[model samples]
Target: MSEVKKIATRASYGSALVELGKEHDDLVVLDADLAAATQTGMFKKEFPDRHIDCGIAECNMVGIGAGLATTGKVPFVSTFAMFAAGRAYEQLRNSVAYPHLNVKVGATHGGISVGEDGATHQCCEDFALMRAIPGMVVMSPADDIEAKAMVKAAYEYVGPVYMRFGRLAVPVINDRPDYKFEMGKGIVLREGKDVTIVANGLCVAASLEAAEKLAADGIDAKVINIHTIKPLDEDLIVTAAKETGKVVTVEEHSVIGGLGGAVCECLSEKAPVPVKRIGVNDVFGESGPAVALLEKYGLDAEGIYKQVKEFV
Candidate 1:
């Protein structure tokens, strides 16, 4: 098999847009004056005419993207997750979600991984905000490979979509070029009977390690990679809850309303089980390295293992 072509989520959006733009003339890129940071610069370079930098006006950017989508254009709006989800939520709901527009909102720098940029830039509530939108498709990929796949999926998916990618260079677990991806489906990275650690984005890798550590302690841990928070794979989550009888949902976002919340909501309605959510508690992010932020907030692998330990 050929080597995997893993690109950062931001980079993937740039590269994939290059391909999508070539095939479809209606594909357009929009940035709230964050093209360089979000890697939408790649699209701007490739197709300058199709890229629009809307300056720091996030609300206007979202409105313009939704408008373009209504006019038969596929607009991929790139910006920081905080601004994309928090700053312009009304636009996302009223313009994009209400109209069911084909607008891909590519939010880079999600979670505390925005790091030194501090709390102002870190979007801990992004998932909660996006998930609350009725017609929004919330996706957060775990690695560069999956990030690329998710970006492609967002392009093809109709209606409002908020897909975020982080800044730090996380472990590239599935970098193989041949790997295919599907939205709204959780990928099973490992199988076990003791307990299930359901996670997505950066936590997928941490949970994998947590599961490994658990196995060494004679605790078989099942890891489910939930890349899509909205339209979550109910079958997979319910089955995992049934098989394990215990679960630990982890994510880089806040503990209140994110992946953990989504999983708990699912488990509560369908497969009731002991769930321990491992993520950022009610706290604002501080300036530090990405890993430090994750550790400080108890969103690391050790945190995941500890949370699972409680439920199991």
Candidate 2:
């Protein structure tokens, strides 16, 4: 294994868009005056004529993307998760999901990792919001590789998709050459029998580290990376639950209706297990550094280690 580099998922998404743009001329991009923040500027630089800046109007941006999709153009809409999932939610549900448009939504700065942007910008319920929309494929990539691959996958998929990207530079988790990004499939990073740690986004790296720490205490933990939130890998979750007998779900979003909730919903019906959820427990985030916020909210590796140890 080589030394891993930490990079923002938004950066990877932006680069992938540029590469995808070169191959497909109909790939259009729409941003709500947040090209730089959302990292869509890379695509805009390469294909200025194909990029559309909707100027702080997220609803309008989503509508425009849906309109473009109707015209046989693949539009990638970019904006902060707070606005993309919350502000333009109605437009997304009606114009994109309901119509089943080929529009890919790039929702950056998801969860509390938005850092100093505070509670207003920290979208803790985006996964819940996007997951509720019918025909919406919700994905949250763990690292740069998965993020980049998902960008291309979302574009290739023929329906509406919402991808969650982070503002913080998360550690590279899926750097193996053999690792492939498949929608609605979960990857098992570490195999163990005591407990299964299912996590997504930034929590995937933290869960891997926590699993290593648990190994020192003779508590073998299985770490599963669930990149796709909606249309979750139910088979993997059921298998883990049946095998491990105990499960822990980790995420940067709220514990009520995010990764933890989704896993619980699956296990409660198929294979019931004692599931411990590690995330922001029904509270808004405050202004702080990305790493600090993660630690404070118990979403970091050390936090996950403590929670998993207590659960097991």
Candidate 3:
């Protein structure tokens, strides 16, 4: 078998942003101090005329981006996930999300993958924060292809969209872009009868690997890539529950109010099945490599496989 190429979501976004900017003259890119860190360097290098750098002030950057968006120009603001969702929350809620502006907030360095930066940079609560904001399309792509697809989809959707991507280079799953990527629809990667594993972002890859390990143990684990958490794919989630009585949700985010929470909310009233949540146990992250942080937070492949085994 050929070795699959590994592409980080952040890098993919940088490339996609450049492509979008070239295609549409009205499209603009904005960054808050960390322009190079978030791959806005590509845009800055190509079209310095359109790229705006609002140094260190995320709230102000968001407001400025929203203001530009109101002028009929699509503004894509890049910053660390923690700042984009937390620091610029008011602007996101009122100026952008509430009014439904044509703005795309590309939040990189999300989850515990902002390795060596510690909890200050890790954005475990971004999913919850963005999901709570009505009219905000919260999307977390599983890999490079999905990241590119989601960016393109968000631009066409015509509203405020938040895309959370990490800095690490994980296995590049789903290389096919022809796959239909409708908002609020979860992609079912694997079908099984024993249990269903719903996951998104970096954890989606881990869940797929864990499902393979579970298969070796005679347990069929279904893997569902939950990209959009806000307008969740409730129908697909309920269908998984009806087919398999067990479920395990995995994410690189906190177990408190992340993808697992979304899954539980849907299943609590709809299907009501046995669920095992795999993610950060509501704690801050420490400085370490991304893989170490994942295991320490109990969101790695081993953690997911172990939790699913217990339910089985």
Whose TM-score is greatest here?
2
| Each prediction's RMSD to truth | 2.5, 1.3, 1.5
Q: Give every collision pair in model 2.
A: none
TM-scores, each model vs. reference: 0.95, 0.98, 0.97
Q: Ten residues in a row with the worst lDDT in model 1?
A: 1-10
Residue 152, model 1: Cα distance from true site in angstroms: 1.2
Q: Per-residue lDDT of 1-312 in model 3, one digit per residue for the tens?
A: 127677789998999898888788988999998977899899899999999999999999999999999899999999999999999999999999888899999999998988899988888999999989988889999888888888888888899999998898878888665566777899999889999999999888888888899999999998999999989999999999999998888888888888899999999999999888887887888899988888877678888888889978
Cα lDDT tens digits for candidate 1, 1-312: 024333456776677778888888989999988888898898899999999999999999999998898789999998999999989999999988987888899999998878899989888899999999998999998887788778778888878899989887677787666566888888889999998888988888888988887888899999999999998898999998899898888988888989889889988999899888888888888889988888877777887777677668
Who is ahead in lDDT, 1 or 2?
A: 2
lDDT of each: 0.86, 0.93, 0.89
lDDT per residue, candidate 2, 151-222, as tens digits?
A: 989988999999999999988877788999999999999999999999999999888988888999999999
Select the stronger candidate by TM-score from 1 and 3.
3
Per-residue lDDT value at 54 in model 1: 96
Off by over 4 Å in 1: 1-7, 176-178
Name the best candidate (by lDDT). Answer: 2
Alpha-carbon runs more than 4 Å astray in model 2: 1-3
- Candidate 3's C-alpha runs over 4 A off are 1-3
TM-score of 3: 0.97
Which ten-residue region of model 3 has the weakest summed lDDT?
1-10
